[model samples]
Target: MTSAEVTRRRAMGAGLGALAGALAGCSGASGPVLRLRLATGPEGGPYNAFGQALAQAVAASGHRIEIVPVSTAASVNNLRKLDDGSVELALAMADAAEDAVLGREPFPRPTPVTALARVYVNYTHLVVAADGPVRSVKDLAGRPVAAGAAGSGVQVVTERVLRAAGLSGAPEPAPVPAADERPLGLAASVSALREGSVDALFWSGGVPTPALAALAREMPLRFLPLDDYVGPLRERYAPVYTAVTLPAGVYGLTEPVGTIGVGNYLMARADVPQDAVRDLLRVVFDRWRDLLREVTAGARLEPRFAISTGEVPLHPGAVAHYRSVYG
Candidate 1:
């Protein structure tokens, strides 16, 4: 080819490349959008389901909310995600958030977090099959138990309960694998117990969790009372633990069972934008009824009940939202 032809071809290629780069920059095809990231628990769990429902609700409110829901280990890991700025928002057990701020174990140092809202009450259920060998937390010793996924809030509560029950040194509970080796969340734990793979399972979630409710239909399940442990847990940790009871009709139990309750918080990093946080609070409270049809736990997120976030401070945007509505 002639030298002039070669030069012209090179210039054309350069021009096309520059145009492509400019278009890529403007469209951000290879870069992430500014949509907010919400970290939830393992897939198929209440956290995941609730987060998805919440994301949908927020998105439907307006184009201002574009949420990307991510499934991670519940609570503990979600806090870690907030710490590292990997996620803008997360659902966490109130106890785990307290532990993180206090620099407790599982957290090497204090991790700052702010409560967007007090979402729901997580009931700690020490569940077993009606005909299983395990009768109580004491009986969990030396038996295969689903202790929740490692690095999850459920596991933290489970370990604490075992310690409080004087069963800490008992053989490590069997890990309920979510998909592989990951610690099982509430849904998987119930499945493990129903399958008879584990003698007992420790699950912390909203009362009448769909999974447990469905399991109750297929077989009779029993919840071991843990009211005795609530006082100790509350005394040792923050006042995040409460002594509560699962009503007789819940989960098909013929009698009420005493258990501990921990509130769940919708948490955000301290630096999350006020406007975005404000929008979140808008959907959470203004359109709450819509969320109720989405997640059964949504019933617990009533406006009157959502302002009790314990030691975790509310985001200023949340504060404003509450004032605007309540005032």
Candidate 2:
């Protein structure tokens, strides 16, 4: 192995040892194993895939902690589950986490959710049939569109994007009846687009999402440019959205497409045990490459990026872990 590979392996081994020691000290020689429920996105989505990989990696490290991945609507739903104490951990979009922590529209009151890390970036995808009538965001003014699952981060961003394009009204906390809007998950959205029930669909996820990739194979697909609305979205909300490009050759694209980007955060309830949180972060950082391979290829994770969760305060354990690393 190369020098870099050797260093990485050594770091992972040390992290595993720290985690094992921490867990052993917490639970005596024969204490019960600690199980944590992690709320992930819908099946077949990046969040779910990442959660599963992280869980497996943690288990393989020989730690006495079990991470149970729970499927749910992405982002918004995940934060709600974390807030209500239904799940100890959750993956959510940074925007959604900010909303939850600040008592924004979707959340009735400020939620006591803390961040574990800013895990990755999610690209907003506005997909339409190659030869469809909706060629741009404004073209969806009267066309039927799948606006993402009802309680998903995709839906929250979709509403804002639509509003920025002057194609929709103010976002409501609950889904409102509209002739052109359909609140469907990734799977259902793909089926609807194929069946001609929806003219377009919006999804925010890692590039080359499996469902979309499969759909690309069945027929031609076009990704409408969303970079133009980043400014408007930032003006209306916090500066949580960034302009990003979907590289060429992904999902059969001939050229890069510009879109809005948002960070994905791993969050936890405010009351979770500090040692548990620290142990989890150890595995996440040490095995981040495995997570990227399982979720999004070409994605990146590092101490700087992981600690950049805006507005969402890091958990005490996370802060401790980072301090130790920096020291």
Candidate 3:
């Protein structure tokens, strides 16, 4: 048999098995066992893809998973959902986790949550339209912009960033945020820019985002430099926020953009069985490469960059696995 045929068969089997597992979980047919739900973002973004990959890997380990798709604006909402027994697992930015637990910014109320693992970096890029007058963030004053969806963790930090830069409107300079009707998921937001609906945008995501690839098709879009912002982010949000660069070819971008970023963590309700968390961590790092294939965020998933929890405690189960491999 040819290599292509073998690859196709493997994919088919995996897809079939995933379907069976999802059905079994929904039907309560996977025998009598504890169940967990994951609140992931959007329908087509990398966050949703990452959630599916995680479900697949866990399903392969004889566990059932029910994925709850939510808005990217709702990552912070995941915390409330987890706390209130609506869902069990979800992705969150590290800074968001810190502030949420401490009752800062968007949270406005304390949320007692912890970490399962440091999953991916949330690189903040001040993206602008190719033909727009805004070359840097300074030039953006009265432009029509999409800050982010309401209840979005990105919106929380983005508001602060705008204050730091003295810009307003959507990124904070505008008197009011753009209506949520546009629903700027990474791909949609970039498309809006290309079409001239939005003059500037801020995206907090992992490197080499597929959405950025679409925007890169525009020959002259620029990433606003934020060397100054990085220092404040580290100081205000915790040292986990680090300097980052969206490299040239990562998105076919003309030049690297200096920016600040934070981590996107895979977290769960504290009530999740330790055994499940342990097994999930084992399957994840073991098949890390396969997971990467399922989502572009995995392209930058690295153990070295995955350990800065600051005060956010790691799940005991995950710490056991991380120490075994890294030590």
TM-score of each: 0.82, 0.88, 0.79
Candidate 3 lDDT, 94-210, residue by residue in tens: 777776666666666555455777766667877776666887656665566666665566666666676666664344443533222233556667767877887877777667666
Q: Provide the lDDT at 217 for model 1.
A: 92
Which pairs clash inside model 1?
A: 149-183
Model 2 clashing residue pairs (backbone): none
Off by over 4 Å in 3: 1-31, 63-74, 168-183, 297-304, 323-327
Worst 10 residues of 2 by lDDT: 14-23
> Any idea what lDDT model 2 has?
0.83
- What is the C-alpha RMSD, rounded to one decimal, of candidate 1? 13.2
**Model 2 residue 289 CA deviation in Å:** 1.3
Model 2 segments more than 4 A misplaced: 1-30, 170-179
Question: Across residues 130-204, which tens digit of lDDT does each residue of candidate 2 receive?
Answer: 988888887787689999998999999998887766667753343433337789999999999998999999999
By lDDT, is 1 or 3 better?
A: 1
